[model samples]
Target: MGKIIISTNVSLDGVVQDPDGQEGFRLGGWFGQFGGKDLEAWAKISLEEAMGTEALLLGRRSDEWFAERWQSRSGEWADRLNSLPKYVVSSNLEQPRWSNSTPLTGDVVNEVSKLKQELDGDIVVYASYQLGRTLIEHDLVDELRLVVFPVVLGAGERLFGETSDKKPLRLVHARTIGDGLAFLTYQPVRDA
Candidate 1:
């Protein structure tokens, strides 16, 4: 069975809003402030994660957002992302426009559960706040990978907004990717 993993870019204050400042957030583009070794290391890490994943699990909005932006770019990262199979959690999205994209049917949790059992590798979710909350609340996420930027956005939508359960996570990996970005990996301690 494939593990459901959530990979998110967050701020020091737990804000996961518009990191590129493209979504009209006041604190948008916070991620662009870094360069040099930090940027290189971060990019490499992200690409590595994508390369390791079997498929991309994303919300409808996130899927569309990624498809639009990546379709025009040409590189190792873009190729990996665009070529991967994408499972989008959207009831209304019939006939996904992106390549190798499929809209999940039935309840989100049920569909995800089935996907986990059917797949053989990691099913990675990227930058889907609402979907992340649903997964977290349902105890569906197995590994949580966070690239925490070193900035505190005082006011913004947090990643974990009042979950239904107390999830205890075991730290699996921690590293400073670049200068200010801290890459932290944690596995949720599920009750056996």
Candidate 2:
């Protein structure tokens, strides 16, 4: 079965808001504020993840955001991302702007479960915080790969929100990216 992996970037304070500063958030653009070896290391890791991803799953806004930014880029990473099959979760999205994208209009849980059964590798979710919460609540997410930047954005959208119940995660790996970044890999602990 395909594993649904959430690969995202967040601030030290767990904020996942506009890292690019395009969303008008006061603390936006925390992603590249400090450019150095750490930023390069982060980009390298992100590229590796993209190379390994079998497909991409995103929410409507995230889909739009990525499409607008990546559609014109030309490189190995951009090529891989553009070529991968994309599934956008939206009931009202008439057409997806990204190449090789399909809109999932049915129930979120059911549709994602079906997607999981249909593929055999990593289906990475990038920058889709709302959809990430729903998947976590439904126990549909298999792994979470979080690259945490060094800044702390006290007030912004966080990677996690209130769920119906506590979701326990088992840490599989933890390391430092470059000098200031923390790379964490976690797996959802399922009850036996």
lDDT of each: 0.88, 0.92
TM-score of 2: 0.97
Q: Give the alpha carbon lDDT tens digit for every residue of 76-142 in model 2.
A: 9899999999999998997998889999999999999999999999999999999999999999999
Off-target runs (Cα >4 Å) in candidate 1 are 34-37
With a 3 Å backbone cut-off (N, CA, C), the pairs that clash in candidate 2 are none
Name the candidate that leads on TM-score. Answer: 2
User: Which residue window of length 10 is worst by lDDT in model 2?
Assistant: 34-43
lDDT tens per residue, model 1, 79-131: 99999999999889887766799999679999999999999899999989899
Best by lDDT: 2
lDDT of 1 at 114: 95
RMSD (CA, angstroms), candidate 1: 1.5
Which stretches in model 2 have alpha-carbon errors above 4 Å? none
